[model samples]
Target chain A: TIVQTLERHFSLQDVLVGKSVLITAGPTQEAIDPVRYISNHSTGKMGFALARVFALAGADVTLVCGPTYLITPEPTIRRVNVRSAQEMYEATAAAFPKAHITILNAAVADYTPAHPATEKIKKKEAEFAIELTKTVDIAATLGTLKRPDQLMMGFALETNNEHEHALGKLHRKNLDWIVLNSLRDAGAGFGHDTNKITVMDRQETVAEFGLKTKDEVAADLLSIIVQKL
Target chain B: TIVQTLERHFSLQDVLVGKSVLITAGPTQEAIDPVRYISNHSTGKMGFALARVFALAGADVTLVCGPTYLITPEPTIRRVNVRSAQEMYEATAAAFPKAHITILNAAVADYTPAHPATEKIKKKEAEFAIELTKTVDIAATLGTLKRPDQLMMGFALETNNEHEHALGKLHRKNLDWIVLNSLRDAGAGFGHDTNKITVMDRQETVAEFGLKTKDEVAADLLSIIVQKL
Candidate 1:
């Protein structure tokens, strides 16, 4: 009985001893001018939390992050820093082939200034508009290029027809799963400390959670991913 | 032609004047003991930003928040602070009747210790566990209690089946609209400096956004709310 109990209580390390995972985090800056650019409020907390969890699970982790004030969670995890969405895309693509699981958590810009001003434009004009073009769709790109054995997850944040839109992206991006959220919901999005979420897979399985800290959520998510693998 | 050009300009204040709005922010702490508790990662940045936006738009705002490390955004906005999920629920119920628009953003802990330990238990750990019970369902409670004229918005974050799960919440919570996101999506969530989101409504309408600052997203989301109202 003593031996059986001990065997049943194996550490998380015993479960994830040799897995490799990649995660992208924070918001990619889209340069509008030398002194000015566009980005978002992704503080890198969620991604950093994921890195910690994955590392704890004994997976080798590569954390690709955008500009943020957060410190790296672990010394052993590999860190790659980049700025613009284009750079992030290139880095992610380069890292994809080597990953067993990829979490695309970065908030990449969908558009960039078609012609970024070399210098800051003066306030001479009463009104002006900058020409914009679509940035590379990072998740969709990864979806198309993903290995069959590799698990790819995407995120969707919608305001209207929230589910339909998220589903559309899930299908379009060829994701194994997609995490969805909304700005209309209160404590769930950017800059918050706690979150509530649902996990959805290609098989249409859903696992919903109530509010929890990002750390706990990451642990829960990693467990789900490990189970899927 | 000259008269038409002059007529195209409109003051920003004209857009938001005389609106009544209720906003909830932060994370609710469920006390296990006087000194210990359960909570989540809700920094309240997004909700505070929304308050600021609505205030800027000329709305009379009431900001209800759980315990957080954030300052009140405006003098005109009324602020209420609460600790437990029960307190948050009471505060929200009190404020809901008087507001025209409501945004539920607090990350209320789903479970509380069934019977909190009177003092911190001494460490003699072979194994430890705490019995948990469901806390008040803030979103669903409000949804059931909402006035017909009140425009309610909900948020969802999922790891998988992003769209389907968000839609389910939209219906479950009786939200007029929902914001959807996934944990796998980068730069869109907790503690980040930036965000990307989608907005969905009862009509199944969807508005997708690229990465933008939290402040910018707040502005955009408020604009939509105003239009819907």
Candidate 2:
């Protein structure tokens, strides 16, 4: 009782003083040329929201991000910007070993131009198809290295089979918790300020949440992580 | 010579004093919920560039846009922001008849949720699919109402059959000009500061331009339109 009261009286800093978190955010660009690339609509809002929440709670955060207009939400949160899936993987891998919790939130490209042209391709023919090759799966790759003490999380954004896909990814990636975003949620996905999410665990337990601003959602999400930690 | 000198001396406003231009920019969202949507990676950069160029050149420009984070480029240029393909179509339809030149630069959704749920959909089932229906064709809809002297331009961004698709769109949509953005072009597609394009006319005249900043490309495009005018 004394320890609990002392901890509460000290500050939020006392609660999370030694905890470290790593987060991956935004959309990775798959370059087709000097002027062309493939990417998603992620604006890095949710991840940035999470970073802000974690930083305010006195946890050290490292944010590895793709191309976005956003700046670091707090001075304490370290930021690393990357352009492609490969670059994101490298940065995340480098940061993973030092963190107690790792959240995979980036919409990294699944494929990239097989042969990006050196020069601008001209309109010689009426039709064309740029060959695409699969990219490295960042989550699965990092999952292999996760220790029992480290908490690993993954996110799934799906148009169909949302729960099945999320559960499958959770097991396959060895994630402790998986956040699922459904396109069926009208105001919940990409570029929006609000989100409704379902958090699934490795044991297949699921907790559904209501539509709320990403800031509120982030706090809710961090509380879940804090409980398990 | 004296008339030309007088027009030049008066101001840029004197040159395009009577010209009215309307542009559509950004990616149209197909809502599935109050908090979620289906959208592409259009940032409204190209359309905004065109609007900026026209406004600076002294033309009265109206910009009907979809959801994007970009701010209005110029104060004098009219701006309208909308979400969903239906909203975009209605706004564009209302503004179509008012301008002398209309440039359809928006990446409007081809399909939308056939039945959007009002409440946040709970993931009870393991697998599910959202049925989608075709959205209104913004370019073809306005093309039908084009006047003899009015110039209508369409933009086609394609991965396959670039020229053939663009040519078909030019005649089918009754566009005076069609700008083609091929994924094959190294630096000529979405979310990039630069572009390389091929402009095709209804008469089958094709003009190819090298990679350049969107601002420079916009100037080149406006010059091409000026020549025809």
Candidate 3:
């Protein structure tokens, strides 16, 4: 019975058996100086979890990561470490051609200092400002460059007009699917262990799941992706 | 000059002074027995972040929480801890009378065991299933019970049809605003440290923010809410 249950839920394992999956995790740092930089609070847990799931499902996984303290899941997964958004984009793009599925999960800095100072600016009597420019849009670039058969997904975290905004991104980025989250939802965002999610695809089908651990959500999501393929 | 520059970009002090806010955080555990129960992957970081932001803004904050490892943020901020979704509903209803703004951030479990096991069931070779029943919809319930002057927010995490579904939830729940997220987007969900978000209101206004620390996003969101007020 146990075997039957497992088989029933994961009957499509053959679909991912030889596929190469790539994932990006953590947040990029945009340096202002040697000691000061702009960054976000991503811990890379979700991306790590996805890597584990893909590997378990028999896909060759390449996890491109920013600086994170979380341990890589296992020796079977190939890991590439990077820091700034520029580096992350280069690493991801380099691996994209070989991947059957690519998940861009890094909380990359959207902007970087136009010119990074060599030393940390001293706090003098006067204030200072740093000019900034938009970082490369890795997901959009991938979307535009994707082959006909490659599966692409994007994520959106919204505080207001959540759906309208996510839909806009879905069309703008040419995503096969998109995930949406809200800051208004407690226990849902960063620095937590569990998540509740709704899955959206090009078909406009919506599937909602109750709160589950990131690992569980990753497995469930991968299952859907497998079916779609 | 520095102060002027700070004010020009964003003024943290001016955004939250006169608001009355209520927030819920952490995971609610539904007891099956005296020592065991059912729960989810909510660590309460997002809700706690909001509590800190609202408190810093000088708003009276009443935090309704579940079990978590986080330190309570403010000494004056009232906190009510509960073990189940039902208890959360009651606590939130009690705090509702005094609040002008409410953020439902808890990832409340959608279902509870129909009959909690009296003791940890010993492992058996045979398969087993536990019955489940729906938990109360805290946000929807609050929306139905809210005062006209109060602003209510909801969250939707979708894998597909990301935006239309969130918009549907906003109207269905009678929310003043809704936040949306998708897991397909990296760096956005549970157990991470950074977040990127979009905000949607009943007025159909949408605001998008780049990847940011939860604290920074909280500040930005509170600023927007204050403007609406």
The candidate that wins on TM-score is 2
lDDT, residue B41, candidate 3: 46
- In model 3, which regions exceed 4 Å deviation? A1-8, A12-15, B1-229
**CA lDDT of each prediction against the hidden true structure:** 0.74, 0.81, 0.73
**What count of clashes does model 2 give?**
16
- Per-candidate alpha-carbon RMSD to the true structure: 20.4, 7.5, 20.4
lDDT of 3 by residue, B72-96 (tens): 8878688888878889988988888
Pick the lDDT winner. Answer: 2
> Tens-digit lDDT track for model 2 on A79-188?
99999899999999999998999999998876666777754443343334555677788898888999999998888887767899889999988899999998788899
Kindly report the TM-score of the first chain in candidate 1.
Answer: 0.92
Question: Which stretches of candidate 2 lie above 4 Å from their native place?
Answer: A1-18, A24-43, A53-60, A64-68, A74-98, A102-229, B1-13, B124-127
Q: What share of the true interface contacts does each candidate keep?
A: 0.00, 0.00, 0.00
lDDT of 2 by residue, B114-167 (tens): 887765444344334455677788888888998887899899887767789899
Candidate 1 CAPRI category: incorrect
Task: Name the candidate, 1 or 2, with the larger lDDT value.
Answer: 2
Q: In model 1, what lDDT does residue B158 have?
A: 55
TM-score of every candidate's chain A: 0.92, 0.93, 0.93
Docking band of candidate 2: incorrect
